[model samples]
Target: MIKREWAGETAVIIAGGPSLTVEDAVYCQGRARAVVVNDGYRIAPFADLLYAGDAAWWDGHQGAPSFAGQKWTQSKVAALRWSLRHIQSQHAYGISDSPERIHSGQNSGFQALNLTYLLGARRILLLGFDMQPTGGSRHWFGNHPPELHRDSNYAAWRGWFDIAAKQLVCRGVEVVNCSRETALTVFPRSTIQACL
Candidate 1:
């Protein structure tokens, strides 16, 4: 089992969404533990952990050497590299309480939330989890390269989070969505400032 090293602490998950900003990343630095998902590390390099589900992302970024924190993924090929922590993947909905693996919600952001919980955070604050596109752009970084997948089935992703929310409540974990704008309403909403 993963040790509850951060028990009772608060964690902030930074995701790659249009609503994310450098200011938001700056505010999280030193304020609380952070987990950056996919390209979020570009803005929050100081994040404690980074999670990406796709192996191609790691390959394209050359293993994200700029990020000094621990890297995690469910991709076995990517995890084979010394820099990453490999958590097995389970095809299911809701959070996986077991430390050995995680439920693949088919999105890196949702998986990052489960990782934060496994790290022993009692309270989790989400930023940039906008499940919908903004200004015709799907992510803050614009779109992925032509070879990579660019489309997101946000409706399906949101459903997974809804299921995860109920599971988290049962575990006594508090989750608050602090995105400036978002379509994910499974958790209670709060402003980043209020959360900080």
Candidate 2:
């Protein structure tokens, strides 16, 4: 079973952005309790992720040959078509975000973020989760970086993250928008260091 040490510690969901590095992983190594993998798209290259959720966000692309051989341990929260296979097994969490008018068939950090939100974290820092796909999709995961592609779900995810941030702030949960590119529209909350 995947040990959720970060259950009570500060947890950050590592998105598929081109900014992740050994330094960041090393920094979050002991500091973070668990990690949430939003999607596996080219994420397997990194492999060392320590998240409890490996939810797949790409829907239509499920048939893509690239996904056939990917592997994830019990720490995965398979979504979409994969969810169809695991839905009866209890891994499927169903449609996370209600409606934001975005092509979510391949976007959303709900499972990971929601997991962190409910994990009793003192504070949450959204790292490289600039869901807008502005920059690249997770760097330092491997020696070769992926050719960055701006997907249609960027703005939608950005809006969704903003909404969640605001909701968490209202519920007394400290939400920090550390995503370098997209700034959240939620109410201001204390930073990670402040919460500590």
Best by TM-score: 1
Per-residue C-alpha lDDT of model 2 across residues 1-196, encoded as one tens digit per residue = 2233344456655554545443443344455543535343344323233222323223333423354322222222443435322111122223222221111223334555554454455566655554443454333342221332333455555555555565666666666655445434453533333333
The segments of candidate 2 whose C-alpha lies over 4 angstroms from its true place after superposition are 1-8, 38-108, 134-150, 183-196
Error (Å) of candidate 1 at residue 84 is 0.8
Candidate 1 lDDT over residue span 128-179, tens digit each: 9999997677889989887677679999999999999999999999999998
TM-score to native of every candidate shown: 0.97, 0.53
The C-alpha lDDT values of all candidates are: 0.90, 0.42
Collision pairs in model 1: none
Error of 1 at 112 (Å): 0.4
